[model samples]
Target: MLTRSFPRLATLRYPLVLAVALMATACGKGTESTAPAASTPAASTAATPTDTAATPAAATAPAQTRQPGPIVPPQGPAPVLGTDYEEIPGGQPWQPEPGKVEVVEVFGYICPACAAFAPTVEPWHMKLPADVNFHYVAAPFGPEWIPYAKAYYASEQLGLVDKTHMALIDAIHVKKTLPGEGDPVNEQKIADFYGQYGANPKQFLDMMQSFAVSTKINQGRQFMQKSGVTGTPTIIIDGKYRITGGKSYQDVLRIADHLIAMERAAMAGTPAAAPAAAPAAPATGTGG
Candidate 1:
């Protein structure tokens, strides 16, 4: 089993405060204004300005695009409504399914807090029950962050996410092979990274600038706007509850588990369980 220590909580109220503070650093370190959505002017419509000069020529086309198969999640204790998660009025799943409980994490590749939360959540996701569906919606918090988000959708289109998701995170944070927050972004470099995992660099770059990728990016932005997500590493439970408080990464998972259990019970027409002990630990760090 994965192991982590829960810091002693000094006060229940501080986690939200600390979460807010940490989320501020999740994204938007770049000096430019946030990119416009697809509805905006054409000048700003591309996910990122295509850097043709930066991309290396490709000898092969990208593999055919494919839809991703489903994945799963797990359960935990009863959680507090406002403290552990906040309800979104008229909220809907990012992608609704009839029988599965969906858990979506809104994250940015360059967000430090997201980088920190990734390892903890990666293994946690693998253990989820077969009925649960886990998804990721990449957040392009600034102009510099857009290329990474586009690369994400392109990877999804090419069915490379299952292999390269974690590696891409490492590319930005650990390996320093790709640009992060302040460094100049090269779409070619981003596409070239996927090339290592069998994606054709040219086709990947082309897909990154494709209409489908732009639509997905805009869709994600609208979902984040609708869900009130403003930072990286934020979890949405069945598109209803926005995870807003957790003293640590473990606490976040605990609350998610609790909520998942609640969702499961609701699906079966049974009452939810009594509240578990609320997480009592200092906020570990920021998410974005």
Candidate 2:
């Protein structure tokens, strides 16, 4: 059985705040300037300018052409810790579904940390190797968090999460709306937001409160507690390793990569290489 604990609430530190600001600025600039280069100004009409010079005739040579090399992806720095976590005596060992490493993010819809980490998490998802299974576990940290968790599962049931996930994040983070802050967590308010994305508001509300959805929310809470997570934006690798988002949002992805490698090694029945040691901290939201 998973033990439950009250979640710790804290604000992100300054360095992370600064990084988020810069990333947002860079994304905005990239979108605004993505158009192809304006047709190069037609080659100069006149001959090259020359300060008077007496020169001998030169032999004409074919223009040298350069072939572009294969595109290479940038390899950023690795994560600080490995993903594999040993079970607390008598706890279940994480076993992923066949042929895949499971990556689960334990998150709360109202968490500023989860919102801050969304953009950084996108690229990592895009680059995941084929033998990986990624999932989101919406944590029910309190009564107020239940509604949002339900909405997340409802969207998943309807196969609409791809369209709704980032939209919900943007609604909360950018629009500054607190859909998950009131008593009962405002199910209707969340449904209305989903309506804008072509989901039926009435259907969304009905489904968000159904027993089936609520059960999933409870399961998410249980999973969080089992993994020793006490905060939002925590990552559980194959249900074995737990990594929390730190001052640097990048740590989340780094830990994810480490876990993936570890899971792969274990599956192959090969001893995984040891990673360098790092500081040890309790799983109470200080960053993974």
Candidate 3:
């Protein structure tokens, strides 16, 4: 059965079950309460079915919020518009920017899926052309994840994401240090984790609580709210397409590459590839 209810744990987002259950909750860490949609699939019966079960037709069906698709690897064609990806109606209405396609990822430090996804997307991101600008926006789901969000903003302010992004994920998901067992949020340990990257533990700690850090965190939360994302590691391409390709994280990147091509084609005034039939409405949990 399709599970749409958010889990009660701190770690938000579902496992990559067939790529659908992504937004359905209790992910690896599991749990978070709703602030509100501020915006933001279909019910698939095959709990363990193929990843593409949420095809065009099913996508038109009204689904409960947070319905998680399955976690199967993506073994399909490049994502279909209005099905695999949801176009941000009204044109990324959130922020107005110029040039350079934007690829934004809504993620959390406590999300194991995000941790696993980092390796998959990072290498691909490095290869993208200058027209694409990629970055991450930490999701402030709850207390446990908010601190990590703070850390992310501070690190970004310090210009250290490339330097310590992997290390931080490794520290939490692998090294198993960095505090926060259940709902615990520890800044000291997180600061210590960044020490190896030339961050002064004291300055890092202070930065985590600084006004500038708070401002960035707030901005990130608003952006996430505007993003209509309820799951971690959601890849949004050029602010129009959200790469929720079913199957593998690699498929997400593959779809991203294809979409990037489409964007480039559009920019050049060339006729774009045929789009998948538009759904009756946008698919929220469906995409992420």
Ordered from best to worst lDDT, the candidate numbers read 1, 3, 2
Is candidate 1 or 3 superior in TM-score?
1
Error of 3 at 8 (Å): 19
The whole-model lDDT of each prediction reads: 0.65, 0.53, 0.59
Better candidate by TM-score, 1 or 2: 1
lDDT of 3 by residue, 1-288 (tens): 111111112232333441233233223332343323222222322122122222212212221222223223223465676556777654462333566667787777776556656655565566667666778888766667778889998888887887777667666655667643254677888898888778998999999989998877777767655555655567777767765444455556667767777776787788966656645765568554
Please give the lDDT score at residue 157 for candidate 1.
85
* Cα error of candidate 2 at position 9, Å: 9.4
User: What are the TM-scores, per candidate, against the unseen true structure?
Assistant: 0.73, 0.65, 0.71
Candidate 3, residue 30: Cα displacement in angstroms equals: 6.1
Cα-lDDT of candidate 3: 0.59
TM-score of 3: 0.71
Clashing pairs in 1: 9-280, 22-286, 25-288, 26-288, 27-288, 73-128, 73-129
Q: Which stretches of candidate 1 lie over 4 Å from their true place?
A: 1-32, 37-77, 274-288
Residues 9-117, candidate 2, lDDT per residue (tens digit)? 2332222442343233211000111112211111111111111110101101121222323323223444444322333222222335786878777666665546555
Which numbered prediction scores highest in lDDT against the true structure?
Answer: 1
